[model samples]
Target: MKPYPFSAIVGHDQLRLALLLCAVRPEIGGALIRGEKGTAKSTAVRGLAALLSEATGSDAGLVEMPLGATEDRVIGSLDLQRVLRDGEHAFSPGLLARAHGGVLYVDEVNLLHDHLVDVLLDAAAMGRVHIERDGISHSHEARFVLIGTMNPEEGELRPQLLDRFGLTVDVHASRDVDVRVQVIRQRMAYEADPEGFAERYADADAELARRIAAARALVDDVVLPDNELRRIAALCAAFDVDGMRADLVVARTAVAHAAWRGADTVGEEDIRVAAELALPHRRRRDPFDDPGIDRDQLDEALARAGADPDPDPDPDPPGGGASTEAEHDAPQQNPAQKGKPQAPTTRPSAPPSATFRTRALRVPGVG
Candidate 1:
C-alpha cells in the first residue's frame, strides 16, 4: 500500500527535521526515533523512503528489518536456492543490499538480536556489507538512511549502537484533543483511500524530494565555521557524552541543517538545532540513565561557547568517519536484559584460607 505523505504528518517537527537532516547528509549516520506505539513512526519512515525514491530515481523504497531476522538474512549469504536449482553458487542479497540507496527501516529495533544490531551498526558505519561465508567472499555498497524506531519501555539499544545513529527524536502522541482528532481524521482518510490521500499531497512530497536532492548537493559545501565547531564541542562536553561520535554527528548535522535551509554557511541556529537532535541519545552516561538533553543546559552551553573567543579548533577532533574504536569494540548485551537489574555477584562465605588447585569459580549463577 502507498504510504501517507510525509508532509501530511502533523506535530512532529523535530522528528521530521531529524529525518531530513540525515537525508541531507547520511554521513551524519541516520535517525533513531524513540516513541510509544501509535505515534506514526513507521509511517514517517515509509514516507521518507517514498520521498527518497522519487528524488533519487532509484528503487529507494523502504526495506524493513524484522525483529526476528537472522544475520544472514539481514546481510546476504550464499544463494541456496540458486545452488539447488542450477548448481550455481551465487550470492543472495539480503536486506542490506536491497536497502542500498534507500531507507533501512527497523521497527521495534530494541527487540532485534545483538548480532543483528551489530550487523546494522557495521553497515551504517561503513556504508557497505562484507560477507565471507560458504566459501563465498562478497562485498557490496549498502548505503542507506538507517531509520530505527523503538518503544523505550520495551528495551534500550546498547550505547554503541545508539551512538552510531546521528540523530534521535523522542516523539509522543499529541495530548491536544483537536490535534488528536486531526491525526485520526488523516489516518482514517488514508485508510479509506490510500492512493487518493497520497495524491492530495503528491505535490508537497515532490517539492520535499527536490529540496532533499538539492540539500545533498549543498551539504558538503556548507561551511561549518570554527565558532560553530567550538559550539558543537562544548555542547557535547556539556552533555558529558562518553565519546567523539556526538561531536562529529553534531558537526555534520549542523552542516546538513544549513544545507537544508539553503544557506552557504552554518549559523548558531543550525548548531543549536543539530545539538538538540544529535545529543539527546548520547547524553546517557550509563544504561540506566534516561535518554534526553536538558534544554536549558544546552542553551547555556551554546551561549557560553559562542561568547568565548576561541580561535582554535577542537584539540582532539575525531578522524574522518563517525565510527570509533570504543563504539566498534564495545561489548554487546542482550536487548532483553537492558534497563533491568543485573544479577548480583555472590560473595564468598569466608575468606579462602587455602586455594590449592581449585578451578577458578565465580559463584552461584543466575538460572
Candidate 2:
C-alpha cells in the first residue's frame, strides 16, 4: 500500500505525537489508535513507519500482523520438513521475530482473538518470546514498538489489553470540507507520482527524523522534578485509579515529552499532557466517558500539589493545622458503635506450661 507522508497527514495531532513519542522512547510501550473508518489511522501509522525507517538508517522493518494469521505464524514453530527428513532441529522465525527492533502494526485489533492477544501481551511485557512447543524449546528477543488501529464500531477491546498500551488516541473524521478536499487532493497526487510526492515532503520528514534522534538521545537525561512526581501521584489518587501503572506511565511519558521539546526538566504542562493520554484508559469505573480524565478535578489536584500555573502566595497545605483541629474536635463514638468489640475486663491467664523438662547437649567436635 502506498503510504502518505507523515507530514502530509491531515488531522489527529495527538495520534501523530503519540507515535513520535514511542519512536523517541520505545520503553514507553505501544500506542493504540481508536477511531472511525477512513480517518487515515492506518495511513498515518504507515507513514510513521516510513519515517522511522529513514531516520534509523535501516530497511523499514515494518511487519503487519494480519488478523487471520495462525499461532505458528505469530510466534513460530518447528520446521516440519527439516524435522521429518534429516532428523535435524530447525527453527523458523515468525512475525514477532521479524519485527525485532521495529514496529508491529495490527489493524482491527479489537477483533483479534483473545488467545492471540494474550501472546502479544506476553511478548510486549517481557520483550522476548519463549516457545516450548512441537519438540522445540527456545527463547528469542521479540522487542518491537506495537501500534494498533481499531474502529470502535467493529468491537471493543478487553480492558486488560487496553490498559497495556502506554497511550490511547481517539481520532475523529475530518469535518472541515476544505481539509477533506485537501486530503483527497494530496492522496491523488501521491497516487499519480509516488516518488514526487515523497520528495516534496522529504525535507520535512528529514527534519522530523532529526528531531526524533535528538530527543531519543536526550530522553534519559530529562529530569522529573519532585513537584511533578507529586502532581502525577495526586492525579492518580484523586481519580481512584488502581495500582501504580498510571503513575509510572505518566512520569515516563512526561519525561519523553520534555525531551522532545528540548527541555532538561519536566514541568507541570508536560505532566498534564502525559496524564491526559495515560490516565484515560485507567479509569476503572467510568470507561466510556468521552473526557476520561476529569479536567476540572485534575486541575484542582494540580493546584493542591503546587502544579498550578498561577499559584496563590499562601495556598492551604495538604496537612495543615486545620486537620489537627478537626481530628481533636471530632466527637468520639462508643466502642460498640464504632464496630470494635470491647477488650476483656481482665486478662486471661496463660495456659499451663508443658511438664517436659528442658535439657542441653553440646557437640563433641565443635565448640
Among the numbered candidates, top TM-score falls to 1
| Whole-model alpha-carbon lDDT for candidate 1 | 0.86
Q: List the residue pairs that clash in candidate 2.
A: none
lDDT of 2 by residue, 200-254 (tens): 9989988998898889889999999876787888877877777888888889899
> Which run of 10 residues does model 1 get worst, by summed lDDT?
314-323
Off by over 4 Å in 1: 81-88, 285-291, 311-367
Candidate 2 Cα misplacement greater than 4 A, ranges: 285-288, 291-294, 307-367
Tens digit of per-residue lDDT, candidate 1, span 1-367: 7888999998899999898887777778888899999998988998999999888888858888888788888888898888999997899899999999999999998888877887887888889888999989899998899989999899788877887888899999999999999999998999999999999999999999999999988877889888677878877887788879888888888889899999999999999898899888777656566667777888899888878775665545577544555567888889999999989989869766875785765678854
The local distance difference test score of model 2 is: 0.84
Name the best candidate (by lDDT).
1
User: Model 1 misses residue 86 by how many Å?
Assistant: 5.8
In angstroms, give how far residue 319 of model 1 lies from its true place.
31
Q: Report the Cα RMSD per candidate.
A: 18.9, 15.8
